[model samples]
Target: MKAHPFLLHKWQHWLALGFGSGLAPKAPGTFGTLAALPLVWLLALISPLWAGVAIVAAALLGVYLCEVVSRDIGAEDHGAIVFDEIVGFAITLWAVPFNLQNVLLAFVLFRLLDILKPWPIRWFDRNLHGGLGVMMDDIVAGVLACLLLHSVWLPLQL
Candidate 1:
């Protein structure tokens, strides 16, 4: 469906679209994930506790933002609505030490889990609907990615 003319003008759409990264002609989800890196870095700079708080807040707000934009554009889980990606990426980086290697690993793993939607991730994506549906699959992906990084990858590095 064609995007609403006011999609960009609305605050919810602006955020739900990942600050316009979701508008990319192709690979909008990838672009939205990329857009989240800077936010992850900033959150890391603040402190893991604060970063956690912000990630939780963003995920909560994302439901409303995603829902409003989806309704406005007359699409469910539109590729252009990517607040889920942003929050998911943030969750993947939670408490992760801010380093290029760690960040890149998290990025690759999160992207893979998100795109692949294995098992319960796919289950959530398929069964849920509306805003919660839009946010959950990615949330699960982020959690899995974070667990992998913390449990397997980080241990191997030690």
Candidate 2:
């Protein structure tokens, strides 16, 4: 079925928005993540540890929100509802420096892992259902990205 106009449909509207990032195309997930920059910045300002904690919290929260939005839209894991991407990307950036290069790297890495959906991610996507399933896989990817970033950083530190 065709998606209704954003204004008339509450869930559809929010879904289109990524709850807000759904507005961008060509790379809605990337844009959805970029849309989370401000929150990422604010969290970074507080502390990396805090940002990490927040990422976990956001992922958990996203599961519920995504589920609700999906049901409203008569879909499952609609591309428009990209809050999962936002939370995942935020998790990726956690503990990383706020530099353009790092941001780009994290973005690429997060998207790769998210899209590739290696082992556990693929497992979750196929086996689990509903919002929790949708968000859980991305959260796992985010954690993987976090580990990769640390590994990349460790060598550079020397």
Candidate 3:
């Protein structure tokens, strides 16, 4: 693939690239997830139910965005297609409190789960194809991170 096949002017490409965070020379996924922090903070400001609804909407849209960019770039899961990372991070902090500790913990956990790709996460990454495939593993990682936060980390803090 070329150094950058995605055009930032195109909304689909712009979003799929995580608002250009994916254009980073290295670790675009990490940068994309970092970019999601502001969105997560904004979501935390709203009702948890509404935040959840928004996340669901983003996830649904991410399917199309990932697919379009993947096809355009002729790469199944191009590193530049980091919409999955953004949505995944959103999912990770869906209803978590808006605080530095929680945010940092969620970030670390989500990145680890995403990067390590354990169990079913790895399974989805390997078995699936297309945009759904691009998004599934990160989705799973987000769920795992969220679960860890609510069930273990948060509880321990109490």
Best by lDDT: 3
Q: Model 1: per-residue lDDT, tens digit, 63-95? A: 888788778878899987888999999999898
RMSD of each: 1.9, 2.6, 1.6
Higher-lDDT candidate among 2 and 3?
Answer: 3
lDDT of 2 by residue, 110-137 (tens): 9899888898789988988898987888
Going through the candidates in the order shown, the clash numbers are: 0, 5, 0
Give candidate 3's whole-model lDDT. Answer: 0.90
Compose the digit string of candidate 3's lDDT tens values, residues 61-149.
99999998898878989997889999999999888887888889899999999999999899999999999999999999999999987
User: In model 2, which residue pairs have backbone atoms overlapping below 3 Å?
Assistant: 16-22, 17-20, 17-21, 17-22, 18-22
- In order of appearance, the predictions have TM-scores of 0.93, 0.86, 0.94
- Could you arrange the candidates by lDDT from highest to lowest? 3, 1, 2
Q: How many backbone clashes does candidate 2 have?
A: 5
Model 2, which residues run further than 4 Å from truth?
Answer: 5-16
Badly placed stretches (over 4 Å) of model 1 are: 1-6, 156-158
Kindly indicate the candidate among 2 and 3 with the higher TM-score: 3
